[model samples]
Target chain A: MGPDGSRPEPPDNPPSSEDTQRNAGARGRPGAGHILPVNRADIPFLAALGVVASVYIVLIAGIVLAKVFYVQLPLVGEVFTNPGYRYAVVLSLVSCSITTILSVWIAVPTAYLMTRVEFPGKRIVDAMLDIPIVLPPLVIGLGLLMLFQTPPGAFVQQYVTFTYAIPGVILAQFMVACAFAVRTMMAAFAEINPRQEQVAVTLGCTRAQAFWMVVLPEARRGMIPAATIAWARAMGEFGPVLVFAGTTRMRTEVMPTTIFLELQVGNLGMAAAVAAVMLALSLIVLILMRLAGHGRMF
Target chain B: MIHFDNITIRLDGFALENINLHIPTGAYAVLMGRTGCGKTTILEAACGLRPIESGRIHLMGRDVTDMPPGRRNVGLVPQDGALFTTMTVEQQLGFALRVRHRPKGEIAARARELAEWLGIGHLLHRRPHGLSGGERQRVAIGRALAAHPDILCLDEPLSALDEETHGGMLDLLRHVHEDTGVTVLHITHNRREARALAQSLIIMRGGRFLEGETARGQLAREEDDA
Candidate 1:
């Protein structure tokens, strides 16, 4: 063992045919090369997992299919033709786009700091950031309502009206959507090796330059999923918009608010139509997320 | 020259305590140690990637204890090369220059020169994902040398290579040191590597350096034999 109490490194020669056969035989399969032989015993476990996973997949597909079938094409056309619905659609598109941009802007830096920095009360801060993700949507809406009633919120409100306004809708959406985007970016940043940035620092890059030139480019793929998630969440935000923005027809009404407003008027057909539109948008987002994640949605 | 004086670094119950080392200018120093014996910690601390609790680091006679890594004028090649996965080999080589806002023409010329010197000119357009271990290391070395730093720190630079590649890398490292006259602090557990390239040698155990006399004696004996 070369007097080092360790196994000697193998010689630099290619293995002979006989040695290859012997090595292959030692692995319990001759001529296997690098191919792994699957064990038959694993089939039942894999099949059970597939079956359990398929149940949820089928359930979601079934619900979407039911919504699509229930909403007649004429009803969808009528919902789209309504000026209120059309306004809600435009507002939803614009607000979600803006919310997505803002969420990503906030998320990237927050995620980078969380992943790369160490500080006291870091765990507490992390949990606090995740409050929006775990807190009930209604509670979030109520919390915003309460926050705006205080001195600081009131001070800001004097300059810009957020209560029952379009800005309020965007803020409400940003509050929750940014949290989801932050989570995605955190995962993305964590997946990257910090060594690259450290190496960049040694290569004469300041911290900001290293982040911009190295970390940001590597984390660029994660932004797609983050933005898609934020956009999708913003499109579907109902409780915060209802509580903070106070769903006024043609004013603060988004796609989710349109669904709520149609239900308030006892128009099940219009509600179903809006739900179908939301479902389609969600499907598109899912497709985008999958592409970004290279087939894994999360 | 690189100097570490009474440097102390603590991480999650592990500590490198009161570490003192010096590698003279233009010297190729190889540090040998067991796994987790703070060999890498010393390199990181010197590079300013890890903060030292107490002590001073001097690069080229300037105390850099509180200085950030970028201003320290050191180049580090981390384990497995750690090439930027998003950038091509050419871009990786030009990264430091680009960050320092060097002229575009100078950056391109330096990248091409380093790539040719490292024998990776043909791999310039390819990213790090598919390069072999030796190719990646060459690209990493080229990248580190791109900025013409005062010192080069390599952590297990040849550990991942096969024997043939390892031998090539040793020759290349020797050539790089001879050509650049840059101080090098290389970390490796392999005595063969230390013997082959080290102008000065240091050994570590239990988070502290062993007696320098014994290490110097070994180097002296090797030189006498040669």
Candidate 2:
């Protein structure tokens, strides 16, 4: 026996050649004789398939890029001279910021409850939150229109309006953006260990205090990416905002609606300018998300 | 005294049944068990993290079975240190005091004293992610004690430490228990550590505590049988 109290072993050596042949040959005998497909000879075929997939992806990207350049780029110059399109881009930014802020303010608590609490109807609440994500934007807009166009809607509108105004645009954007934010925040919260908050509770932190002090800090890394995604979703919201809030210049007009209006008027330059701005915003947000993850890797 | 009377917890596919123990004030008790044998579950029940189907927990002569974890007034050092990432070591140590709204100067003094006591004086400014595993546990311990809890519940606090680090950690913990005279309930599977630190030991298996005394003697008997 070794000094560590383990049993001694024979000298280490490879198994005999006959043993190897027996195992290999036995695999092809009777019930164990299964045909094996070796991929060593299919290297050329697999490489060709990979090449084909890449070509398809690249071709689609190229077409999108061409449309962007031909229709969107030249419009920036025209927008600089035209006050209408310039106002539209500014309005879009303002709407997106409002949407993002409201969504985060509400979704932070919603996400905390979803992650940390156990309630009877939690699953139903979670399912309800996801409705906006899958529902068509036009359908949502139509629903909103019907809801607010009635007597109750008119009664509420006397105090707070929701039809074809900045508030309407903000409301529409908030609905869609909050749904997206909740999903992102749910993912972020799931990545965090619940034990962190439990530790906080043991350290004399109240539920709110634990959330703010322990849970929020550890989740910040992932939550930042979530916020970026929410921002992109808010900025890219088109159909609901267009249908519900109408394309009004300097008031309710946003980048997407401006692009649409420009497209209808055959003003590709202005449309391209707005699309370029939207693309740049999305690109910056995406890069920020990627960089945030990259920073965590090392 | 920290008392658990006939405590039972039923959680999906697992249960802790009929646990009855009384750890007197200022005595260091250890819960010895294999991994996933309800060592942590007992601690969780005592601290109110788990709802006991039927039980009673008396801490400092008060029934705390229905109390929420935040109101338990007993400090817990979880398996992972669970230190706040956003706070520096000093801030984390003073978190309980901050929550209690203690004076800034008092909090500062307490944080420093605890840090020095835990041998983490030099790590006051470091974040938890940057500290070594042993260092983080020390910080966690310091943070737990800063509140001046009536009792301390540790769940395998030194299990993650390396061999060399474990000795120093045990020594530090021994000093802390002696100096403060706080009742300590530490849980671990390592008999050597249980012998070193616990004056009273409870052996557990499959969510039930085995009826026995003489921890070292029991371990020796098991060894002989094997």
Most accurate candidate by lDDT: 1
Give the TM-score of each candidate: 0.88, 0.84
Across A1-298, the per-residue lDDT of candidate 2 in tens digits comes to 2111222122232322222323332332344433467588888998889898899989989966875767644556666567887787778778888888888777778987898788999999999998999999988887888889899998999998788998999888888888988877777676566777887787788878888878786666556655766778878888888888888777888888888888899976667777877777677767766677445211
Evaluated on chain B only, what are the TM-scores of all the candidate structures, in order? 0.94, 0.94
> What pairs collide in candidate 2?
A72-A272, A75-A269
Off by over 4 Å in 1: A1-38, A285-298, B211-213, B216-226
Once superposed on the true structure, which residue ranges of model 2 sit more than 4 Å away at CA?
Answer: A1-68, A71-74, A284-298, B211-217
Give one digit per residue, the lDDT tens place, for model 1 in B60-112: 99999999998999999987788887899889999999988999999999999
Tens-digit lDDT track of model 1 for A139-198: 899999999999999999999999999999999999999999999899878777788999
Top TM-score: which candidate number? 1
Please give, as one word, the docking class of candidate 1: acceptable
Q: For each predicted model, how many residue pairs clash, with residues at least 3 apart or on different chains?
A: 0, 2
Cα error, candidate 2, residue A182 (Å) = 0.7
DockQ of each model against the real complex? 0.37, 0.24
